[model samples]
Target: MPSMTEPKLISGNANPTLARSIARRMTMHRGINTNLVDARVERFNDQEIFVEVYENVRGEDMFVIQPTSNPANDNLMELLIMADALRRSSAARVTAVIPYFGYARQDRRTKARTPITAKLVANMMVEAGIERVLTLDLHAAQIQGFFDIPVDNLYASPVFALDIRHAFAGRLDEVMVVSPDVGGVARARDLAQRIGVPLSIVDKRREKPGEIAEMTVIGDVTDKVCIIVDDICDTAGTLCKAAETLMNAGAKEVHSYITHGVLSGPAVGRITNSVMKSLVISDSIEPTAAVRDAPNIRIVPTAPMFAQAILNIWNGTSVSSLFDAETLGPIYEGMYSSQ
Candidate 1:
């Protein structure tokens, strides 16, 4: 752990709003004494990313906040080049704080000839002079092993649980937490336990990429408020299909709560036409304008938990409590005073 004064937060063009939100949660103000050096991220005729940090950062413990969201290559290269520049400037330490890690879905190889892009990204960060990393709700937790340095994987379950608690309040019992697939059962289970509700699973089969076949739902959801929980909502196909299945099976109402909202393709339109009553997602990734203006979609901030985690890391405090099942709410006081 590093000292409070040693850490300095920086930002890139990717999701500046989330970075600002995290900063506000950290300092309890709109802006901190941090610097976002003006860098014109451009490419040559050969299509190569170029970055030049305008401000000096000699011997400072720097953290570059950038989510590898849309325009993945551009944002990713920006983070990499920023780290390299900071390294060249003699920074004491560099930590890449990526709220939304892109290409995390390719953590493993399912075919004979395939690239483990997630591990490749980890290698890229390490080679770019990033000594440590901070990320949230990785598609696969084992991806942490891909990195040689310290990789802190934060959980968004606590944040989502609090939101669900407040949003439904007395109607929580009627809610049934639904995991869209078997891979997400653990995540949904955690949320169900926190909100004290029964759990259900959508046993679906992926016939091909970007498509899903909703076979049958396990457990009871009839006449119950259904809540689908997952780490990411990319394309929103599985979620929409699952909601339709739940609705067709006599579910009273259907909703969704996902950590990352990667609303690509026709996801927005699909979600609009789906049987889901509402879709709740966190601001880990920047949503498109259509996603932002969607009537049924809402974004909850993950800034408070992240800001507290940063403070704890700075103060050399225990972050284990953040994952404790019993304490599923953001830690107040201590480092979370502003929250």
Candidate 2:
């Protein structure tokens, strides 16, 4: 018999490894009887998704862990259907835990007649009975406004900062954090501030999708190890181009810390051939085989942080405090290094 005080964790197929990790961490950290609710999520012959919850969730707090990653539409529909199933099954509440919120890049309209798909997705979730959202490093922070329900946007900076600290190891001055674009300056600056390093920005022009019109380094990177920070690395065109630009401007080496590794298409090949020394990404999205096989790519698990946040939410604690870089307190002490 499951206790009513414990939250039931459910997962869709989007990123099963991360979901299971979060459940395990919840058990280990909270000392609560955490259970991963078994559910059947499959496809019908017509390519429609079917979801059925196998356990009773009536009046129990329920959480659905599903990242809208590759096959974005299908995965998204699965989340919606699962949320709907939980709501209809009389679950007290359904909090959608989407580590990598897909379509977040389209948070706003870049051109005339364009759609704000991020808002649309938010509305869809709310309509599907999602009472809350837990996501990591949204491409645009303002996307939180799209949801009327509480949305907790988590960061992977602390995890990256720990690894960078170990990698630099008392030579942090030689490192310069570089934002791949002007928009990411804040994100890069946060990491730089945490590591006590200088910050730079990459000024780039994009004439079309998956293409870089021009790229120029905006700050001094001469002989400095540059680390480019961004939220996603979809095709790796911008990252590869920015790395080349940094090297041309006299950077000693270039690395990247991206939150979501949506490395679709030739992203792995591009990063492998680029001037970048390494590309570190959080396992927000389940990595594809190419991402796993790439020589320069490294993955850091985000489940521990997420598990803590879930516990905090259930306990009515402050979730934003988790973003404090200093408070993370050596959780990765000897376990992480810049590979």
Clashes of 2: 0
TM for every model, in the order presented, reads 0.91, 0.95
**Lowest summed lDDT window (length 10), candidate 2:** 330-339
How far off is residue 3 in model 1, in Å?
Answer: 2.4
Cα lDDT of all candidates, in order?
0.83, 0.89
Top lDDT prediction, candidate number: 2
lDDT of 1 by residue, 51-120 (tens): 7766667777777889999889889998999899889989888989999999999999999899999999
Show the lowest summed lDDT stretch of 10 residues, model 1. 330-339
Q: Clash number for every model? A: 0, 0
